[model samples]
Target: MTDVTPTPTPTPLLEVAMPALLRHARHTYGAAMRAALAARGYDDIPANGLYVIGALALGEAPLGQIIRELRVSKQAAGQLVDALVLRGYLEREVDPQDRRRLTVTLTERGQAAADTQREAREGIDGALLACMGEEKVLHAREVLAALIGIGREGE
Candidate 1:
């Protein structure tokens, strides 16, 4: 009798296209963040709102950066900001340095919401780190960053 060696089959994840993997992977973080936000009473953020609020929370990001990151038109960005302002999560004030221009700042409610968002994101990061281990996580980050760079090179 001849001994048989079974052929290896690719894992489901290994067979997924990068784009599909990215989309689904994004949903995992989105679900975690949304669940956390809802539990913490921050369910009011609109579609595309999370990126803006979280960016503001992290620090000063330029309008150009926001537009690029959101992949949104300037008009769309303005409308989003307006909606956030109306929701009481953000406030717009006349720029002290330039009276003709306005500055958007986070309201107290926004700050709380941002904190919740950060915690939720950190939770996902921690889970990934634990599951993938340190070296593997770092390599994953490098690969993702390279993918992002590919997009930028086209722009």
Candidate 2:
């Protein structure tokens, strides 16, 4: 009897590339930020908590808005906010115009954390630009922006 050779299956492309790319970028940037913050005696904050702090980088925002922006469950957002508040990175106050609403603002420490994240991101971006060139990186940014815009369209 003649032996038959088995056919090899081809590898499939990722179903969605953005999520994988974003996850990798987040992990890399988070590590750099964590290292920088740790060097400055700010090691208590977790990497995930940094996202919440970054969301408030612009200014105070309602808790509900932050939850929406974060795209996280209410419970998850609340836990993150609670942790940040306990770590002195954030503060919550009642909205003057709407006492029923709670607003979140970054503390000085939170601002420092956000600044560290920015620096880390800049470093990562520079490295990416060097590796992939400005044209490709800029194109990628545009694509990412478009994708985000699509996500926000429903809001």
Candidate 3:
């Protein structure tokens, strides 16, 4: 009996470098975002909570829709909504068609929070873009578009 060893393929640049770069980018971006939010009296809210607020700011959505859009567990999404509700950032309304179904909407406070966060994010993003240069940023966006196309090929 002979045993055969499979030959290893050379690692692709995107495969090896992209994961780390993406992770670092997420971490760095998240930290900067958090700091910006904190500077505007939003430090009490959790990061996920802010996301919920932002999502609701777009329009009134049911709890289930928010959960699905955010891709979070029901319990986690519920907890986040609950916190936002307690903090006066959100309000729960009974769906007109179904009383049993609840919809979450941002209150005035939530809208303010979302707007403040958006402004902070824009400032941070603008600074990063300025530093990276418009050309490089455009090139990076093109590369990401290519990656997205490749990723969708299997689907």
Candidate 4:
């Protein structure tokens, strides 16, 4: 008397390295967002500027905080900020609570671009949800957050 079941075959996805998977996944979002922004006449946004814009849209985070998140050198961060300001996507203003400090805020054009970027991202999210279902998508987020936390642990 025997009770036997067949072993499952590994999927092709299992063959790909984690880093490669992450890079391509990022490219998917990046391409979608860039195309959407460009279609709306925001083609001039500098590299990594989207991250700055998106972070600011979330809240009034300090430039230092954005720099840390970007993991870019201080000089690079300074250059990024300068480009964004010059591009009319950001404006330097006196900090309301700290009169001695200057803060950067998004201009009207920046808001419009942010909105377009967000919609593009949401479109990808919606597609993921539709294909993967809610439970699977939530699990994917959990896995990604854990991976992000691993990087943070080194700091």
Candidate maximizing lDDT:
4
Model 4 lDDT tens row, 13-116 = 77899999899999999999999999999999999999999888877787779879898999999899999999989899898999999888889988888899
Candidate 1 residue lDDT tens string, 49-143: 88888898877895558757998888998889998999988899998999999888889998898898889999999999989899999999999
Give the runs in model 3 whose Cα sits over 4 Å from its true position.
Answer: 1-16, 60-65, 145-155
- True lDDT of residue 109, candidate 3: 79
RMSD over all Cα atoms, model 1:
3.2
Per-model C-alpha lDDT, please?
0.89, 0.80, 0.76, 0.91
Q: Give all TM-scores, in the order shown.
A: 0.90, 0.75, 0.71, 0.90
Reference-based lDDT, residue 113, model 4: 85
Give the TM-score comparing model 3 with the true structure, all chains together. Answer: 0.71
Comparing 2 with 3 on lDDT, the higher-scoring candidate is 2
TM for candidate 4 is 0.90
RMSD values, in order shown: 3.2, 7.8, 9.6, 2.3
**Model 2, span 1-155: residue lDDT tens:** 97789866644434447688688766888888888888887788854687777767966675577678777887877788888899999988898999998778889998998898788778888899899999999898899899889988977
Model 1: CA > 4 A from native: 1-9
